[model samples]
Target: MTVYWFMMAWVILFGILAQVSARKVCVGEYLGEEVYESRVHLFVAVVTFAVIVFFAGARSYVADTTAYIKMFNDYPLFQNAHDVIFDSSAREPGFRLFSILIKTYISDNYTVWLSIIAVISGICVMVPLYKYSCNFGVSAFLFMASCQFTWMFNGMRQFLVAAIIFSCTGLILKNKTLLYIIIVCILSTIHKSAFILIPMYFVAQGEPWNKRTLLFIGCIVLAMLFTSKFTNLLTDVVEQTDYATSVEEFRNTDDGTSIIRILVESIPIILAFIYRNRIKGKLTPIVKLSINMSLIASGLYVISKIASSGILLGRLPIYFSMYNLILLPWLLRNIFDKKEKDLVYYIMIICYFFFFYYQMEIAWGGLEYASKILNVKY
Candidate 1:
């Protein structure tokens, strides 16, 4: 707990420091308005990246990290690496193949593997924040404070795949749908859940509060109203996809998503809807896509809570949730007038920090960190 708490504090403090030293993100103005164009302070961002990647890579256990460590060790040595990677029954060959190459060429130790993976995942996530976020510092804070950083610590396969897909934020904003879909197709081999993002490419397009946005809301409402029916349909789809028996495993274990998390995810989209008309006229393509993705993430979280299977539906939102880190900071900067902006900023900081503590100390209270290299465990 202390390690995580310290890591979170260090990242947020540096992130805010980076915000203090801004650079010109664009020449004149953003969104056709003469607003703060200077952003993405590089020095502090690199610092934040280092601290985060270090802790993530050094971890001995955090939700599925120990499992991944075992998996990495059990992977056969380089002699049969090709067969293992190319095996027809391989669920996600890309990651397996990647692990083999690292083991074959680099050190075979899992520490080396975890460190390398941590670096890759960190870069994938941070690059997008550097490019799209209005307040890179705030977005960095949001990433940790919102507990999205857990993706780096656990769920390595899916989150790593998601991080790679997130790095292609440019394609989504540039309307390079075909190329983006192609990328998703390739990454789906790393984690099949990535295949879900294929249809989301279309869903993420267009203006905020569009008919598609309404449709997402409608889908959530229907899923909530007819949870049993939705579960059966979802289960059939899962079966056909041929993933493990996650459906049955979690079918009756519906503790549901935390209401606190749902509110945290919901706030940004709610704010967007309130300021929809004001923001619509000024939104950059990236911001628009961020809002749309935020909408999807929030909706999924809500449905996960209302529906019968929290784990099943909850897993789906990671595809879109990173965009909330982008969306939230942008909303804070642009949506309010000058006087309200400061208040909103403080309120955001307080709420997010509280949520961070709640998640780490209570919800995920058993989270422990151990590392031989660091010579510390807590």
Candidate 2:
């Protein structure tokens, strides 16, 4: 536990230091005015690894780790393998499949397999994010380092799917819709939630809308209403996995205010609407919508007691939070150019750390405490 804590502290320290030593990323690179720089990508990758290591290493194996352990323990699920073609399990079959392969290689050493898979998957995902951040600049970097990406630390398979989405957003935004769809389809095998972003990818590619895009919203609402019937499509993965029993017994535990969501979500939506032209300078309408939605969801969850456990609201915000991976660092870079740059930057970093720390405390209290215990300095 003490060693893990020191590792995390070192990661955070070295991550920020690496970022500070790098040059500012240029907008021209994103627009094809200039070529992408490997140096910027390298810097972001190093920092991303550090940040990811801090959170992941700080927390002893839990959620995702447990899932893999269960899969190995449930030998029949792997050997009998009834649904090998299409996994209707709670977790994406893709990730589980990887675990199964690992189980074959290290049949007698599940823990080692788990650690190895976790590290490799993390680096695979981080590389793409690092490249995208390099192409877009510091804004993307900061957003990735914040609470949003940190939360994903616990859900390995889902995190990989989400990371794939983030990695491809740069290409997706540049009109590679066909390729984006294919990539997301592949990610869907790991986590069904990845499909939610399929529509999001298209929505993100276009400009802001004056009217609420209720089509997909309506579809989601309808799906939620008829979740039991359509459970096959929306949540089949959960059914096949260890989560099957729990997910079936779950209810719409959320009774929070939609007003706050509407309000906070309005910030970015309105910004995209008002400055639809300029917001395009660094962000997309989907990014703005996603960020605002997360803020609203987080606020609502905080205010509501019942839905706190459902965590469905939290999921919405998590999806949106990825945009901040790039947005926050850019904001910090700007602050660094201001009068009290050093002071402001340090304050912001501390604030971000505490903000993320507390947000995790609220999101998964036990996990937060576990991380603190593992990362205990002394």
Candidate 3:
């Protein structure tokens, strides 16, 4: 717990410094100054990246971290890549191959492998953020505050896949269909959930709060209300995939989606709706995509709430929830009125801070059980 708090403190401190620096650059650009990238901007981004990698790479405390370590230890290094790739196991093939390669060549240091994964995932996440966010600090702060950063310590392959998919946002915005499809195909090999983005690309291009959006949200609501029936109807289809067994297991669990999580996810969507006009012109494609993805995630949360099979479906939202980190910051920066902008910014920061606290201390407890390095004893 102490370690978690300490880490959180650093995240907050560094995030503030980065936000301040980013705000200056934004202001300079607004004033028609030819502001190239600033030292402070580069420094903060590097520091934030390093901090996340350090924690994510070093920690062995999260539940999934242990499973990942055990899987790496148990995997046979000499296994044929083709066989592993085509294996019917529940594990993602790309991750399996990753583990096999590490075991085959790297020292049997699971920590090193974990760290490498963390660095790759972190870079994939941060690069888009640095390039696209209206204010880098707010985006970074929201990244931590929304619990997206902490989630990186767990859900290793899913986050990795999501990060990779997220890196293609520029392509999606630029309407580069062929290249985007190619990238999505590569990333889907890492996690099947990534395939959802193929359709989502089109869905995100639609106007926000329009008839199409309303219809999409309505369908999700209906699905959530009849989750059991929906799951039953989809069971046969689900059984045909690699996730069949896991889906079966989750279907039997009684847990539902977190209400607090639903609320947290909804805040940005609500804000986007309220400030739609202000944000419509700036970062147009990216904002539209973000709003669309966020709505999809919220709809998933609703479905998670009413389904006995909610736990499995719940994982689908993170792919979209991450966009809020970008969307919210952009909204804060683009507010029409200066005083209102500052007010909204501070309010957003405070709300995100509390959300982060709740996530670490309440919703997901025992966050301090992490280690700074590998524990050889297992």
State in Å the error of residue 345, model 2: 3.4
Q: Over all chains combined, what TM-score does candidate 2 have? A: 0.65
Which candidate number would show the highest TM-score if scored against the true structure? 1
- After superposing candidate 2, which stretches have Cα over 4 Å from the reference? 1-8, 23-26, 29-44, 47-60, 76-91, 106-108, 134-145, 149-153, 208-310, 332-337, 340-347, 360-378
Candidate 1's residue-wise lDDT over 207-254, tens digit each? 887888888888988988898888677777766552555666777776
Estimate the TM-score of every prediction.
0.94, 0.65, 0.86
What's the true lDDT of residue 85 in model 3? 56
Select the stronger candidate by TM-score from 1 and 3: 1
Kindly give the stretch of ten consecutive residues in candidate 1 with the minimal lDDT sum: 24-33
lDDT of 2: 0.49
Could you arrange the candidates by TM-score from highest to lowest?
A: 1, 3, 2
lDDT of 2 by residue, 256-356 (tens): 33443334333333333454454455543335444344333333233222233233333444444455444444333422356665776577557555644
Encode model 3's per-residue lDDT on 1-378: one tens digit a residue. Answer: 565555567767887787666633432333344433322376688787677787788887676788888888777765555676568755477778777888788867888888888888888888887776766666776777777876678777888888887887888778899898888787777777778777767767767887767888888878867777886765665566545668757766547678888888888788788877666655455677888888888877777676644556677788888888877766665654898878877777788778878878887664655674644222
Residue 83 deviation, candidate 2, in Å?
A: 5.9
